[model samples]
Target: MKTIKNENIFFLGVDIGSTTFKAVLLTPKGKVHHTVYTRTKPMPDAILSCSGECHKCGRCNLGAISKTIDDFLASAGIDRENVACTITTGSQIVDGLVDFIKYDAYVSEISAHVAGARHYYPDVKCILDVGGQDSKAILFDEDMQMWMSKMSGICAAGTGAFLDSVAAKLNVPVEDMDEKVNYDSKLQVSSICAVLSATSVNKFKNRYPLGDIIGAACRAQARTVMSGVGELFLDYKGPIVFQGGVASNNAVGYYLKEITNNEIIIPEFHQVMGALGAACLAAELYEKKKKKDASYEEKSVFKVGVDELQQIIESVGGTPLAKKLGGLKNKLFVHKSDNGLEKIGIPSIKQVKDAIGDVHLIREFTDIFDKVVLRKPATDKGYFKKSIAMRANITRRELFSRNRDVPMVWRNLFYPPEILNAFGARTVTLETYAAFRARNPKKLQQCFDRAASKGYSAETCSFLRVLEGDEKLPTPDFAVTTTEPCQQGERIFADLVRDYNLENKYYTLHTPYKLSEHSVEQLAGGLRESVKEMEKAFGYKLEHDKLAEACEFSNQAREYAMQANEIRFTSPPLIHGSDAILNALVFSPGWGKPEFVELQKTFRDELIERKKEVELYTNIEDTHRLVWLHLPPFYSKKLMNFIEVTNNAPIVYEEVNHVGWDILDVNDPYVSLAKRILTVGFLDPELRVKKIAASAAH
Candidate 1:
């Protein structure tokens, strides 16, 4: 029997690109530790805290960086005993032996920008990176490695500082500049640089509005940037990534979209790419350092911000990136690939390949190729296989059988995305689906190409044929389909809101079915008992049978429990099998006529009580104001009591549009008595005595 001993390991990548420095820490199996960022400022503390990782190997920094790392480690409560390795990048890396070592290894920031963008937008062949000081345009083939590269090596015109300078002079806060430009829809500022543009704006200020001037500036900046991108490639192959710090501006994003006639993807952390790249690089290096120490650990994903990491650093006194270098010396050995042999130590290529196994390090440092370690003896890379729900977008509650049974027929006719938002579900079109699908490797290159050129759809995204094989994307929690009915027996219509306890959290949605109407009606009997207290407020005595019925539904609405086609009764005239029961419970104050509105109000007030709800109607404030405008004449708080019936006018009644009213003469003999009687306001005015029939019938 042969005995084999293995060490635990990790890897890191430290990317010091043009604008920023980034550090990434990952296990040998590719689990990321943390990603940190700091601007290009020469703060020694920031540098060391960022790159001087731990005590895997010890060496002198550029003095300032060393101290910064030492102080930061002290502050982090970490002793220099745990880290196994460290890597450095950025312009400052030109210091000493460490400088010479990584200079050749140092990658351009553009690579990470391209790589990460490729991570999100794989179809990006023609790409432009517009940043703070300069902008770079790169044209690449399908794989996204640089095929051609161009730069605005000398210009402050289309940069962030340029925007900041103009915005400050315009009396706008730097952050507010983007919002202001977005709102200004008409201004045309200068594109020719700060001095010339300022002159143009100042010269035209007397005749042009400030907004128009700003709008002009916005357009000019967009034009200048597009011109730079045009210098790279004219026929714009996408997904066009608008990366770098300036990409954070929505105005810039929108403007680029209009100019290129191409969609722009401003990723969530576009401003922090340099740092993310640096972090990713650092993580790759750390994994190499760790390979010297421990043999194995399953890869894991974790979430943390900078602050949480501070606590980790503080826990170990700062040193090298290892278990413990001397005092915090880590006992792991992996050969160096190329970057870190001199400053601390490097493992030869043979030791690295033997220990950490196979990892493909593409020269640019963005694309990482890792060999899958098989626990179950399978060579399958799970990356390409994921289950995604593809018809459309579904609500969280729509997973139920009841709601699923309710036809999506209405969804096709008038699917207000607002309804999905209201239901805590999202509604996305095929375009988003296409973009999301691009992340799937099974999708062909031509599919993305055509979608980018002609726009994506089921007609486009799914055009390649083969509806035959079972190809899955990420498994979706729920799927929303369009035009097709749900699978039989799987159709759900249960309103999760009514089925769940948190009704207020879902106040915006119609009640979901959680209970049966019959079960709810049983509780209505008990609800009738509470009606005694509600009768006066409602201006009517309760009918026990009807009141009991309302209670049953209300109770069921409170408790979301039901099956497919089950009456959740979560909402009225909706969310259930029927509304006839509640509709019957509410009666109009008028005889031979029905006041649907009053019945709705009465039923709701009795059920929900005086508990103040947020925005009582969908239209909210506008609807409330309209209600006040249509207030009854009998309820007039402004009418003078002593005024006699001199001018009867038209004797208008709102009911005229519905059941309607008859006209009364301007000088009727009994006008005074009739008008005064009308003032008290009967519960159901339309059902009132025949003497005062609808006076203004339509």
Candidate 2:
């Protein structure tokens, strides 16, 4: 994937790491244009730009780097064509960028840093950097030759993580931490671990002054660096350069100077030295290459305009349907709002349904999902809004894949998608479809009107009404319903089957009134019969081994959910309410599928990382953590964000997330699954009340 390029003007370098995504814009002569050092979501969902104001939330995996480049160019007032060459250096490499953005060269981090440092100070002997996660000390010989580069290993004791955690514990803003140094205090912090250091500070806060505790923490961090790579740092010659994100801390820099007894030089753009280095290296390589290849002339690197690419795709196959799909191909399901946030803008239910016919559209939808819903910085208002839109986008694609490739079952939320998944079938739950339709209010009203046109009562559930009116979505070959959880869904499903004249394709799931052995056996019997019926309809056998495998994945997804839920307990909770709810929606119905499981795991891992960061550095106080008793409106994110920003009240947990089936025992598959359904809150009203009360008390 290439973009329009020019030989003159700017050279670009991007460095994406676990904590921050840094970019440097430089001229061919190595003069800087603009530089950005952005703190990422600590997850895969990369933030293109999220200052106190504008925010663009997107996936950080495939298109992360490319989007960063595009946004950077746009923000810097440089046309993509004017960028001479884009270079990349980072720990993680995204494949989506490789196809879209043509990089002039890729260099190692050490080499880039060396070139960047040398450009500024020709005879600098050593470089010490304390970044977000790791710390590095680069040693140079008399000729400024690279000798040894020692870095903090897996432990992040002396890095930004440690300082951030301690700062939060002391109720000091990270920017103000250095000013709180009390050098007169004789406090020694032995632990370099973030949590441990925070614990140590918290203990001393009562016995000592806040400034003194911060002083001890800073010294401890500086000492930890000495312990890790002090020998080489001390052995290196004079004029050492201290750079990286943590180098901004005057106290840490001052301590290093005292300990090393050397002149410490902090360069311009110290926080983003790695990115600057990468840009300098790119500029050097581009100049060298142009001199070596006399015939090389710069050309546009763009693969093609979106419209042109769509045309190419259409011309290869040349059909009316192909052409229509080609037109829709370049358009993303979500659109940007005036405030720079993304919104789900599928004009109507019919258009989204029609898009399913083109496999390209399905692929496009999934590709934009960013794989999993990302956890973004709380300060970015667009983060959660964009996440909601992304989830809604995926819901449509999943519906398409189910209708086209597998035996589609129109079911309700209470009915598990796992049963259908076992026989290689797909489910179109009422709640899921309704959630998608919520993006467009006019379409929602049309759906309601359609339900009334079909002779359904005005009092019918809104979810069922939307499903009844949706004529563009492919008709399901099979349908399943339950009697207890929601009577309206069963009644509407029955009416739908009758109206379509496909009563034989429908099945009624009977549930016992209470949680008893007989009830479990009854549910199991229903499941077994449903599986047999599905096998007959889909022309596939019910392989217990496969069912067991799906159950294991279901269990794994449950485990991940549990982990994420635990992290939600952190102050200024790391996981957003919308992200948690969307994650539950992903797994509640489709937990058995590998993709759903993978997404849950990704979301969970992101939450864990966020928890680690927030627990350490979040300085916000008086946070009011709220537990929502029921599901909020999926279409409107304003309510959630309003509560979060205006009132400092973040919805930490939703009751529905806790209602899903717990970890399953694949060994006794039927009984385990039977018991899982038996535990649903609606089946026992007492359990729902108790669970809700428990959440509130916490």
Candidate 3:
């Protein structure tokens, strides 16, 4: 009944990455030990570096790679011979070993990297590992299985090597990045490939301070990951924990933070995530191989001669037999159940480990039933009772409001923080967060398959995977790795159009506006229309949706809602009268342009006598004759200073969308202009719509 993680046996693991060499010893309980790392030296150097001596040989430098690990273990007084298992990867180092010696099981380089990442962020849907020789982002489902894996082929642009290269150029110690990257200003870096990025950084040094440039270089590198590795990914949740050696740079983390509202989690053991996975893998194998006599051990060997290896490989190289063999790993199967069936895992420790890969890498949901803990206390209740209660909601108990009745966790995840400062972005509504998580699988596979059907390779259609990650797509009923005993229906696409425009589509050529006596009615349509325009102009939609059955955060929307609330509450109150409306009337056409509010005192007095005057009592409470425009929250602190310069006339936020606002005395002529605009909506709905469209188009 004991779990694999709870066992006490130990294991050994080594990751020989294209950029660096890493080795570690791990207990079955997942404790890491005797870890070592060195920039990938030549193979001969790598072998020699593991020796106990701190000496070097001719024609090569191991650069303290293996020795570093041996010394660590020696210092801890651990005997090397006592280690139970050893597994190797990175640069196909173990691929050659498989032909000469037998391994309990062998894992591909992609699997090892994913396993490492999963150990740190179990809910991580997409993992971007930027290493020395190559970089890749592996997309996994909610179950922590690799839905698809991709590599950067031979790009050096976003990897840690770029950082090291920059450090070399800047004369900064590689280890001292923390101090050097403490930039006061942003340093521009590359936008394209690595070579270009370096050039950009160098050119940026002429005009800006070095610290600022460094900060920019950090941003450039972070963006490279997004476009390079993360570009193809879809779903990027439960949380993204950036692991690997490159993540050690705090600035890179900061730059990445700018793009993702989700706070990046850097594990305590971030740099050693891979080594730990390897060691844990070794432990699983060692524990599974029981002690036996010579005859029993002989029985464990593969029942084939050396020629079988040649035969098996040649079959994979292309004859009819090879084509058949290549496809053996990807056969489709079917499973049927109410909600579909869950996978029944293999019993062997090695097979299970590979199947599970490094769920520990993304840091598996430490406990299995985590997602099952719904946002409420009813999660533990029986289905019948839950269903009955859910169906029993009384219409009379519901409270009516323009605001959305969504839970806060769901709220915070979708809205961007900026949106909240603008009615908190609450009157703003889009898709739900839960739907987005459920639909991720569909988003990735359908797009991937469609792209593949055309000209796009798995690598080229990576954006689908990115979307899936955002949605926390569910795992396929059956993945390629572990074959199920029975067939399961393949994952399929949903009704694309219905899912895409579920909010109900409206058609309009010119424009429309809602006009009413209510003050809320006048501003609401303008805000809504302006918001939709923003969406189309950007081609970016950041709403949470309930897809099939998954739940995720509509974090962008939640944030925007908060911003809107701030804007609504912080602005000035109503001011009106004939004299107040006539004194000032001038406006600029662009956003952030200079606006001046000048009252012609002599002209105003003569003009006031000619026009009919109605007194609007100053600071009137309810039933005031005039409507007032208040300063937005962001402008409050600034206008407070402006108020001192203006001798206490309240600064008014403007009605025009783009023009900077104006400040006016309650008795100024500009007040008349304000009253005319406010009453326009109530004058006529049809005329108002035409007027609004005409004004907005300009």
Candidate 4:
């Protein structure tokens, strides 16, 4: 440690890296006085609370980082007034810091790292640094002249964050890396891409021990670093200083030694070296200013023009990436049938809707569906696994490309899907379609914005907000709605009818709460009128023969549903919760349709066959079976997989599965149809609860 000419003059440096923030205090001689290092987000409670207020004033960035610095200073009992100058360095340095504390000196992170490392190891010829999200290497020749520098590109492989992510997946703490990794283990991971490496890690996790897997990950990270740096390491260099957060990992150090064949020196505060470097640079700047007696304006180069970019981002109320993605309008071409229900190529309107998230982070449902589900063989057991592929094909051929000579009906869950099926009409559930579009949280927010802009109440269900804003759905020739599933459905239906000017073609059923004979007839009359309305609207007569035939198909589907439930309740369940819910997604929306009935038969027969084979397996264990009430989340299929696969708690039954499956009376069609809707238990709140409880009891 060296003393400066001015003892009162102190230099403060802040390094705000992608994953963590570091603050350090140094005398004019660059001797460290205090230091702090921690993650950037999930900030310390005090800073987070201050950020809340700053966020209200559009100064959150300053409030958060400055508060963190303020707390760090307080911990060291240092006053800001004693600091003669302060400097900041990082990839995300912004002008907002000037407004926070009037500290405007900004140094590039690369310069800071070099200066910081040179302070401890003056003879060091090269620096290897791996931060949270990126990696870099700098080399110099014998004359101390900078020769080369290389950095990992946008891919975050070979970085501290990448290692942390893999550690989380393996259920191992990142700090335990030194003890967990077996250097002698021969396991290897070849992918240099962070996303791809994660997939590899997950694949090998079950096959390899934690120690060997982490060792492989470490080797892969080392290989990735060497690959990024290219042949620059081969140049003669010794005393290579390893800085940045990843320097803390001993396994990474071991692999680096093996690759570089050079002694790697890790400084005492390796994780906060960037901040120390910034402080050293600040010390130099302070000394120069004192000797020259010149006043250097405290300002950042980026601060001059950041206001324009800030305004642009604020105008859109999101990151630039979100705005750019939101502006994109990609069209998907499809072949259409006359009925308008039949179409090819456009499976769901969401497939064409612009993805809503960070450009790099967007995960399209279509990609996952095609690669994971659609690519699965048709013979795969379980309804969701096999039937989803089956249903997707059927939906494209029958619903999208089917004959549409009859009038089409757009309805909600409360309305029985069978009546529309019997009338030879195409039916689409508005809620289900909205659910699909709302899978991504950002997209859902966009939908909510659209409805809110039109003065729709935010208190309304999210699905309804999406339905009100989504205009891509085909215009139905007639709308059939029931009055029992709370007032929300009726309100949404009325709004849609009014918006589309379909007042003359709308039918409503005021279904009864009780299942008595009189209530049944009252409900039955309302349904019968809906059938007559369809006839008048389409200029076609109601055929009693077709109605009876469809009822028989409904009975067969119901029979299969009962058998499927029994199979699920077996000791070691052959069916997953998602499969059961998926069956309802297909059947509840398309009950009485021939394709749905056949799919049900396929599911039932496959389960019966699987049961026999599963019984032969001695290792199978019965998992906790939870009954999910109401509809399954339509946003992401991965969530279901997490619950079923990761948590191993499979839902055996969903309330929606009971729709139109309670043994309809084929002889008295209208009365039976009315009874099904009332008994499905979605009509009333208390009844739905009781139905769920009863199912759980069984």
Residue range 1-698, candidate 2, lDDT tens digits: 11223435677887776688888988755577899887763336555553322122334344555576787789999877676566777766444445556565566566667666877887767888778888777887656454578877888788888888887777778889888788766887755577777677767889988777777777788788878777777666577888888888888877777777888888888877777888887676556534422221122111223443344354334544455555665353545668865745432323432455654343332222111111233425332344444455456655667356667777767666666677777677766777777568889888888888888667877777887887765577777777757677778778878877767777788877788889888888897787777676777797887788888888877787666666675455665576566555523566677766665566666665555555442323425688876667666675666455423466788877774555677776777777777776367888667766775665
| TM-scores vs. true structure, each candidate | 0.35, 0.44, 0.38, 0.45
* Clashes found in each candidate (C-alpha, N, C closer than 3 A): 131, 7, 102, 7
Comparison by lDDT, 1 against 2, better one: 2
What ranges in model 4 sit over 4 Å off?
1-385, 397-399, 402-404, 439-446, 585-587, 618-621, 637-642, 659-661, 684-690
**How would you order the candidates by lDDT, starting with the best?**
4, 2, 3, 1
Q: Mark the regions of model 1 whose C-alpha exceeds 4 Å error after superposition.
A: 1-93, 96-105, 142-146, 201-211, 281-698
| Comparison by TM-score, 3 against 4, better one | 4
- Candidate number achieving the greatest TM-score relative to the actual structure: 4
Residue 536 lDDT in candidate 1: 33
Error (Å) of candidate 4 at residue 448 is 3.2
Q: Poorest 10 consecutive residues of model 1 by lDDT?
A: 368-377
How would you encode candidate 4's per-residue C-alpha lDDT over 1-698 as one tens digit per residue? 34587777678888988889998899766678899988886433333334333434433555677778878888888777677667788887764555565442566677888888888887667888889998888887556466467888888888887788888888888878878888887988854777777888888999988888999999888888878773667765576788888888888888888888888888998998888988887777656534422121121111111232233334335544335433532212334468664424322213322333332222222222222332222234343456666666655543354457767788877687777778788777776667667776877787788899888887888788998877666788898888867688789889989999999899988877776789888988998888888888888887888788788887887777777766666645566666567666423666677777777777777777766754532113434577776667664556666555533456667766653335777788888887777777465567667766776777
Task: Please give the distance, in angstroms, between residue 553's alpha carbon in candidate 4 and its true position after superposition.
Answer: 0.7
Ordered list by TM-score, greatest first: 4, 2, 3, 1
What's the lDDT of the predicted structure labeled candidate 1?
0.37
Residue pairs whose backbone atoms clash in candidate 4: 339-404, 342-400, 342-401, 342-402, 343-400, 343-401, 439-635
Q: Candidate 2: lDDT over CA atoms? A: 0.67
Candidate 3 local lDDT, 1-698, one digit each (tens)? 11345443446677767667777667655666457766654435344333443232322233333454456557646755445556665664532333322223444566666666655555566565667756676666657443576676577877887787777666676556756664556445675676666577676666766677677778877887777777555456445667778878878878777776556777776666676666666665455433221222244321222233234435335433344323432221223558876433222222222333333311111111111111111212332232223222211111112234321111111122122222122211111222232345666466555546644465532433233233332222111100111111001121221233322222111112232345334343433443354344334442312110111111222232223222322322221121122111211100011111111222223223322211121121211122223213221233332231211233222222111112212232123222233333123456545544443333
lDDT of each: 0.37, 0.67, 0.41, 0.70
